[model samples]
Target: MAELFQIAGAGDPRLRDYTDLRDVSLRKLLETERGLYIAEGEKVVRRAVEAGHRPRSLLLAPRWMESLADVLEATDAPCYVLDEKTIEQVTGFHVHRGALAAMERPEPLSPETVLASARRVLVAEDLVDHTNIGAVMRNVAALGFDAVLLSPRCADPLYRRSVKVAMGAVFSLPYARIEDWYAAPDLLREHGFTSYAMSLAADSVPLDAIEIAPGERVAVIVGSEGPGLTEHWQQAADHRVTIPMAAGIDSLNVAASTAIACWHFRPR
Candidate 1:
């Protein structure tokens, strides 16, 4: 049987969570009775469904409603079918992704637990751009890295744009944020993993030269693109590794660098 939704016009109080002028802070929703982060696009929403994230509700253009039958059937949440203009007005940004979902953030993973069974992990420090963060996670997942550790300054992996850009790999990958960035390397050491900082310093060993022993656990730390790894992280790392590139190129984007580093350190 097809369910029905009586159109709740834009500005209806019940739809407050969906209306926005500025970027709706997912954290802001946590303050109110209904706390949810927005998940955009068809694929991401599908991934969320497959990941067992129940949607509180959905907002989408009328054209998208019929196309997303499988997704709707997977959940009992209300689907607010609207026209494109209505979606644009309510979301503040143009609703290019066609469908959006309101989903609660899942319980975060513990750093120790995320790394418990890992042989290789990727550690990101203060990589703020959502696209870069997503790309990094996608690369990490595709290239055989086992887990991800993030600094406090790293953007939320669950952010809608991040999720979309990552093609939902963020949901599949194991990740946890290190509470104190300064103590992160020590934590890796305590976990019996060797920390290698990815930086471009002349003293740094080339990525290809850093050999890994069989059964040895390793963590690759990538800092923000411009500053590379901080001095404290460098001091804490067992070694500093750099990608060998042409002389004219100053550096690779953090995402590109991450892909290369992760592949080299991937478990054989």
Candidate 2:
């Protein structure tokens, strides 16, 4: 059972894990160095724990204590109770959800290990926006895609804001970061996946037109929101593809585009 401690001030050293949450650079550096990630809100916290992530500790307001009672009871980590004012002071923002948890980051899966069991995969390249990454992860989990492959520069799906926005889909979805961007295209091909790079190039085929051969696997590659896919991936993909749009709109956000492509190429 988690031991409960009352916090009197924001300066308490024990609350270090939950500090400066609004400072992206600080949080990123701290989390990466310590191998810890924060889960915010009640649902995300529950989902993280249920997915087998061990919590280092939980921070909560008094009102939230009863709501997360089961979660706290399952671990021996300390639960630091603080008034809303003190929490705001330490985290640099009001935790409206009233609950937060610092969880030990789990080991990362390798591309080969993830792909071995996955048939339909979504690859995110240079997508640095955490919310977009999280939203795409939810789509990947809900749309029946088998796994996610991320480029070296993609945002961390385990980031606090990302995890909350994903509603914990990050926990259930198997994902890996590709270190060698140059080899990624060939690697997917060797796995027998028909890779389609979502792009705006004139020669790009409509997403619906991609042929799915018998026993053929599929991979959808989505690029960053602003610049879209880099020239390297656009040229390397088996086919450059685009979602046919109507009216004046020529493009959609990566998150929206991903859903349409996932549904179009869903394993049939």
Candidate 3:
């Protein structure tokens, strides 16, 4: 077992990193020498561990020491126990969950590599919200999508809030970014995938109208919330699909739409 440390006051410099709370980009976190991200709550940490993310350390309120003993014993990472008041002060808010972990970021898989053998993939274009990114990954995992592809502007799937909201699914799902968005569909096509762009344009076909061939490679392209598919992408796709919606509801949330699309196109 590694050494255990105790935090009794917010004045300790050791808690500096945990302070300065603001949204931090995944790129910024990755660039850090420590190569770490904060994952909060026992459930998220446990799921992250189960998904194979390496933990650097665990921080907990003094009350959780015995309850989380098994996890502490299982790794060489140091465990730090802090008083409730200090934890709140250092973290900038009260955390009733009582546990958190810092984990190392793994090497990213390339989009081409992630798509090489996939039968189905979800392509995200500039979906910058961490919550939506997390929700999309959860959908992909639930509905059997093989991988996720992100355009250059998409949110980082490994962001702390995303990891927590995804219930740690971010650690389990295979994903990668494509630097050139326009060229990716062509590459996917060359690799035997038929691209389907999701949108609400008049020319778009209802998902029910298409016959998805079994064993054929397919990729679904989804744009951000406000702008649907880019005109160039829509023109380039083999087909355009739209979900049927009730009157007065402009459209589903991008995450909801992603889930429906994944379920519709899941492998038979």
Best candidate according to lDDT: 2
lDDT of 3 by residue, 37-124 (tens): 7778887877777777777887788777776676777779877788777777776666778787877778889887898879999999
**Error at 39, model 3, angstroms:** 1.2
Clash pairs of candidate 1? none
Per-residue lDDT tens digits for candidate 2, residues 1-268, read 9999999999999999999999999999999999999999999999999999999999999999998999998999999999988899999998898899999999999999988888999999999999999999998888999999999999999998889888899998999998998899999998888899999988899887877887778899999988999999999999899888887996899999999999988888
Q: Per-prediction RMSD in angstroms?
A: 2.3, 1.2, 2.1
- Candidate 1 wrong stretches, greater than 4 Å: 1-4, 21-34
| lDDT by residue (tens digit), candidate 1, 38-154 | 788888888887887778788777777777888887777887777777778777888787688888777779999998888899999999888889999999999989999999998
Ranking by TM-score: 2, 3, 1
Q: Identify the runs in model 3 with alpha carbons over 4 angstroms from their true place.
A: 23-34
Candidate 3 vs. true structure, TM-score? 0.92
lDDT of 1: 0.83
* Candidate maximizing TM-score: 2
- Of candidates 3 and 2, the better by lDDT: 2
Residue range with the least summed lDDT across 10 consecutive positions in model 3: 22-31
Candidate 1 structure, TM-score to reference: 0.92
Cα distance off (Å), candidate 2, residue 37: 0.7
